[model samples]
Every structure is written in C-alpha cells, then in structure tokens.
Target: MKKLTGVMAQALTIDEPVVLTGTAPHGILVCDGGSLDLRGGVDDRLTIEPGGYVLLSGSCQATVSIHEGGLLEVAGTLSGAVSRNDGELWAMSGSCIHGRTLSAAGFFIDLEADATPQEDAPRFRLTGTGHDLGIAD
Candidate 1:
C-alpha cells in the first residue's frame, strides 16, 4: 500500500490501493479499479469515476461526485456535498456526513442508521443493476 501524506496536485489512476494520510487540498479524479483509503482531509472537488472505491475516515470539505461503478464507504466523518449518480454509499455507525447527499433513482444507499442495534453495519450488494432500481429507461 502506497501512502500519500501531502498534497495531490494531479489525478491518480488507482491500480493499487493508496492511503491518504495527509490532506489533498487540490482534489483529484479517480477512475478504473483500486481503492482509496482516505484518513486525512480532501478539499476542492472530488470525482470518482467507474471502478473506483473510496474509504473515507477523515474529512472532505468539497463536493464529491460518484458515478456508476463507484463506491464511497464512510467510516469516520464526512462533511461535504456528496452526489451519487448510480454509485454506492455505505455509511457506518458513528460516522457523520454534514454535507448534502444527492442521488436520483439509480443509486445504492445503506445508511448505518438502518441497521439493527445488534448489527455492526449493513453492507448492501453493489452489483445491483440499474434495472433493479427501475432506471432501465
């Protein structure tokens, strides 16, 4: 696992898992496969394309756009605008998203609050197609 503890000035293509232990104030664009372990802060606009998965345990002070085939797993705190267009958002317990969440009919959302008190966190199946969400048109 590669670690980035500073600013990310350019876009990154994640073929391997990368850990952000610092701050990405410049933001970035991610596409195609791999994981982003965000343990710090990411400002500006963050856009995740298809096949990208992000685990945010820190803070984000910008807008996040997740398209199809992307996933955002919040385990800590998320404060920013998050928009999902056919993406998946799995919010764990004790995590807070102070920003707005925008999603149409094709997004997959499983909040931590929906789980039973005995359950840790509910993980929704991400492979559900658009047809299942009635967005086949």
Candidate 2:
C-alpha cells in the first residue's frame, strides 16, 4: 500500500464495503465521513468512521486509536503482535490494545482504556539488531 497523510480520503466517501489485501508499510487510513470495510492485512495505522469497521488478519502490528466522536468497530484475526511500554500505551486519549482482543490473542478488539495514561506516554526503546540503516531517510 502507498504511504498517505492526514485528510487523504477526507472528502472521498464510499457506501459499500472497502477491502484491502496484501501488506501496507507505514500507512495511515482514516475514514472521517464514510464507511470502510477492512480486510485482513498489515498496517501502521488504520481508522474507520462511526459506522465503519476493520476486519484484521495476518501479523499486522499497528497502533490503533478510535476517536471519541468516531468509532472503530473491529473483528477477525491479527496474526502479528503488538508490544509497547505501559506508560506510552496509556498516555494518549486513544486505545493502545496489546495482543489480539477479538476472541484470542489474534482476534480483533473493542478497546476500553483511559486516554490520559496513553497520551504523551514514554517511548519504547529498541536495542541493537546488528544491521544499520545505511542511509537515513
């Protein structure tokens, strides 16, 4: 999938179900005023409207947040994993779901956590991986 920014699909509205197949790297899909039907895939950030929903599948590890005014009704399975510090995960006024929340560890979720603890939370530090990014973006 292509990398996008805020208000990319703001005006673009769809009534039918929208599906996304394959992998998406560092992408953000926001539905401010439409219905979005998500497919099984990986994404960095995915947001659906009040009546929208996301059906996730595969090892798609991402930070999901459901707007107070909006809604993110999710279902299905997530093959990927999510890990973050307790501080950062509970700092924002959003949801930081750890592990699958649908039915099992891979199932989707309907987060119900405090936003205060998640906002401005501490960042997660990463150790060495042996390889370095040759050129910084």
Best by TM-score: 1
Q: For model 1, how does the per-residue alpha-carbon lDDT over 61-118 read when each residue is reduced to its tens digit?
A: 7677788788877665566666554687665544554532212232334444432211
Model 2 residue runs over 4 Å out of place are 1-17, 49-52, 57-59, 78-137
Give me the runs in candidate 1 sitting further than 4 Å from their true place.
9-15, 99-137
Query: Cα lDDT of all candidates, in order?
Result: 0.63, 0.34
* lDDT by residue for model 2 (1-137), tens: 23222323223333345555444555435454444544434456544444444434233455454443443332333323222211111111222334313212222245543222222333222111111101111
Candidate 1, position 91, lDDT: 58
List the lowest-lDDT window of 10 residues for candidate 1.
Answer: 128-137
